[model samples]
Target: MQQTAYLPLALALAGMLLSGPVLAHSEQHAAQHSAAIVKEQKPWGIAGEPGQVSRTIEIGMSDQMRFSPDQLEVMQGETIRFVHRNQGKLLHEFVLGTQADLDAHAALMAKFPGMQHDEPYMAHVAPGQSGEIIWTFNRAGEFDFACLIAGHYQAGMVGRIRVLTN
Candidate 1:
């Protein structure tokens, strides 16, 4: 009779232990997602407001590790909606940053393959899906975008953006 009574309590303890990591992961993801929504200014630009978007650009990602129309031109101070379509069978991401920043990030990604990050200037797209990043090119200079998913960046999945002075 005592063993039967403890059975339910033991199962509850096991459930709690098993759920601890899952809950922590969920909380971490929520925090990251929330932080991403906060608009922050970068040397390249700030997170764009939908109402201020000047135009939309569609870019394609494929298993070949290339972005279609990889070279892009944008006028400084223009807000653009970047639509990333993943036509590949694997997950991909579009991250905009300076070349130095990208190189450092790619190295980190290679070291920690399971690292999860969410930023206003990045979009993670799943296979056959799409993602978007609205950004304002407030600075005039050259910039870069790439898939910093471990081996993806090494495979030449990169693009260039020239923010021309207006």
Candidate 2:
């Protein structure tokens, strides 16, 4: 008798579910209005927008041997602000380059602890120190950034920058 009593309740549940999808179609009307607004707005700003330091890039290095962001991008002649913090026990340097240039510069920097690279966009932050490097991308290309500290680069303290064409 109890089992039979459940049959009507189950049938009501089935009917409700069958009609549930039809009720959901009404939501499509509200979503279409928002989609139209998105199609008209450019979140990244309009084309030909001026490139400047409307913000800064904050990065952190740690004692465990890591960089907050191992990759970056910039535009030609755009001033980028780097707020780098050395959260590590040792020193770190943000040196920019191509693989070949880094290899060559690394070799030359071997003689000196902090003086060998030619291309700019380099900064060395000591432990517990905060440093900054502001540079404008003058060319469009990919560049490698690495910490030239004694054995840090070998341990993989490197990143890349994709500077887009102006």
Name the candidate that leads on lDDT. Answer: 1
Segments in model 2 whose C-alpha atoms lie over 4 Å from true places: 1-54, 111-120
For 47-150, candidate 2 gives per-residue lDDT tens digits of 12225564578888877667889888777556677778999888787766568866765654563454432223567788999887655566677777787776
Candidate 1, pairs of clashing residues: none
Candidate 2: TM-score? 0.60
How far residue 14's Cα lies from its native spot in candidate 1, in Å, is 31
Lowest-scoring 10 consecutive residues by lDDT in candidate 2? 40-49
For residue 109, model 2's alpha carbon misses the true position, in angstroms, by: 3.4
For each candidate, the alpha-carbon lDDT, in order, equals: 0.91, 0.65
Query: Residue by residue across 13-104, what tens digits does model 1's lDDT show?
Result: 98788666656755676797966477778888999999999999999999999999899999999999999999999999999999999998
- Could you tell me every candidate's TM-score relative to the true structure? 0.81, 0.60
